[model samples]
Target: MLLSACSSAERGPVIPFFGAYFPSWIACSLIGVFGAVIIRLLFIKAGIDAVMPLRVIVYLFLAIAIGLLSSILLFGR
Candidate 1:
């Protein structure tokens, strides 16, 4: 299937830098955190951010979502 082809069976991609290896997930998750910041900014602009009783939870959720999406897109399933 299309998904099977795209999905990786082994560990996800890794970045080699100066003889060190870093999992790609870390990079994507950081990007996701940045994305969460942008999303929070947008919510603030829309005045919806004020309504959230738990802003941290919402932001964390957004970050996790973005990270997963990035991982899927970059590495595969």
Candidate 2:
């Protein structure tokens, strides 16, 4: 029963919409930049003094790292 459950839990392929037009490296980098811009803008507009620009950059870097790692593991040659 445990083995059956584990097998059943395995996921099928995920189909990306609009197809995989962009390469993972470029896609991840652009997404990171956009996310950083949004975060910085929101923090500034909200007057959140504690949320520095560096924090946004750090968050962006982490996001990009995760994305790149996932791409390499899941789609690399």
Candidate 3:
């Protein structure tokens, strides 16, 4: 049974770009980081960042959420 679970078809999704293969999650994570930076810039422009509590944690989770959502939506992973 364990052997059956190890089929080659079960390999996780990867993206091919520029003659290199990268795991889809890596792309999603980069997008998330970019999104977080843009969001922070917007927040600063609107003067909202200073009012938020635990700003680091909020941004960290925002990046993580963006990464996971993009991963699911873009790669179906």
Report the Cα RMSD per candidate: 6.0, 9.2, 1.2
lDDT of 1 by residue, 2-73 (tens): 578566675558988799999898889998999999999999999999998899998999999999999899
Task: List model 3 lDDT by residue over 16-55, tens digit each.
Answer: 9999999888999999998899999999999999899999
- Top lDDT hit: 3
Give the winner by TM-score: 1 or 2.
1
Report the C-alpha lDDT of model 2 over 18-73, residue by residue, as the tens digit: 86544456665655566657765776789873655667457767667666665566
lDDT of each: 0.89, 0.61, 0.92
Lowest lDDT 10-mer window, candidate 2?
8-17
TM-score of each: 0.75, 0.41, 0.90
Which residue segments of model 2 deviate by more than 4 Å?
Answer: 1-22, 49-77
Candidate 2 vs. truth: CA RMSD? Answer: 9.2
Query: On lDDT, who's better, 1 or 2?
Result: 1
Model 1 quality (TM-score): 0.75
